[model samples]
Target: MAFREYKIGTRMFGIALGGSMMITLYMPSLTIYSVGVTETGLVKGLSYGHNSGFSYEDPFLQGKGKPLTVTIKKDPVTGADIDPVDAYVYVPGTPFPSAVRNPGILGTEVAALSADDGQVGVATSDEGAVFLVSRGDYEGETFPYIENASATRDWTAAAVLASAADTDKRHVGSGKTMFVREGCEVSYAAS
Candidate 1:
């Protein structure tokens, strides 16, 4: 009925790839939502965060009303944010799949959209794809798509993501920076 915003807990409860990514299984039917919403951010105690400091670590990308910066992962070994993967694309939502890491499951194929508004690229990783989402709380944001060399926070459509390298063009997804968690909101994953 509603296309909720995504957060760190939004990843499905199916299989987890490495630690940063998960193969979606039970989060059925994702194309696009006609309604708008806002997802809560991760809380850190109760200092009223974000000045050292963010309200919470929101990974989803957006550019509607609020402007968000993309989160980059370090090499762990290298400790640098150089040439980051940006984002990862899953199945039906992203038109291009070969450019990113394949979940190698039912997600390998894109589902046919009925009245498609077309899909844009988002992002993910292989180790722990902790998908986060919003149940009507994350305003001015949506999923993140990393295949574009940068996050999709600019709100560009699928066409802008393409280029000379077909691979780069096809690496589309819903993740630009961030899905579901728990408590009252996180439980929505199961529902």
Candidate 2:
């Protein structure tokens, strides 16, 4: 007599063929069956057994759009506990292509990270927006996050105040006089 094993998913079963008898067994929780065979290889046995096992849906093939969230955080001092600040966020108006508004979405907003403490959160809205942040000496730079959807240039100021509340940390000079080389205008919402 010889035995063969077959596996499907996590279950295994065995089949045995003898001179005139055929036995089938399911394992781990073995169930046995006996049958009589003719010379022609035809076997008489129970037609249907237990079920073919459980059916499962493919997990990777489903879902669409699926909302996303992102958060960004920073700390100037290593150990001292400091409240997280809300950075700037802005999205430009839709652009016109050949004098027509394209069918894309755009938006921008600034929010603090959740209490759980994380870096950045990217959320999906029906609208798409470019998020921008200003830091160090480049604080004055300002431009729409999504500049007309197509323009990659960011219009920014030449200097930024490291700490707006402290005069000593100003990015331009050491308690020094400076020139305002032409005036520039920027529109942004402060948190």
Candidate 3:
């Protein structure tokens, strides 16, 4: 019996070859395939869109203490309608505020608008602005919002609809909870 020895990470293993005139073999690394967590302790397999507005702690405005309000407009009396579904607000150095729950006053309907014909106001303690985005607008269909020193974004419409379609889904257990928690609402175009 002919024996072939291989060294893997300071350990040696032997393989027996029997009656092999010509054969091809492939050896892959023994590292476990990662599905979620990365070496840097961050979640993997997630993508984000672009930054649409003023970012917190922006280099241009350093040490300028001022609370900024971000409004998502649904209609434009003078120009064009603004879709609230295509907007996201990012507050750097702070966690994204949970979407206020209500019937229509201020909830995560994704259709809520401010008193103005086209605006959803978002109050920020820090200097930041709202980011306007659309489905599949940037590299990925996800919107990347930086908050609490971490980067997060809204899930695409496909993901949201899929989550809502599931019957056994619950509010807390549902994947679309982020949409509700983030006060995401939809806005319709005025006809």
TM-score for each predicted model, relative to the true structure: 0.15, 0.14, 0.20
lDDT of each: 0.23, 0.19, 0.25
Kindly list the per-residue Cα lDDT of model 2 for residues 1-191, writing each as its tens digit: 66654355225232223312332223311221122111111100000001111212212311111111111132222223345332221212211111012111111111111101111232212232222221211135322221211112221111111222331221111111122112221111110
Ranking by lDDT: 3, 1, 2
Q: Pick the candidate with the highest lDDT.
A: 3
Clashes of each: 58, 17, 13
Model 2: what TM-score?
0.14
To one decimal, what is the Cα RMSD in angstroms of model 1 from the true structure?
A: 21.2
Indicate whether candidate 1 or candidate 3 has the larger lDDT: 3
CA RMSD (A), model 2: 28.5
Q: In candidate 2, which residue ranges exceed 4 Å CA deviation?
A: 1-63, 75-143, 147-191
Instruction: Put the candidates in TM-score order, highest first.
Output: 3, 1, 2
Off by over 4 Å in 1: 1-84, 89-152, 155-160, 169-191
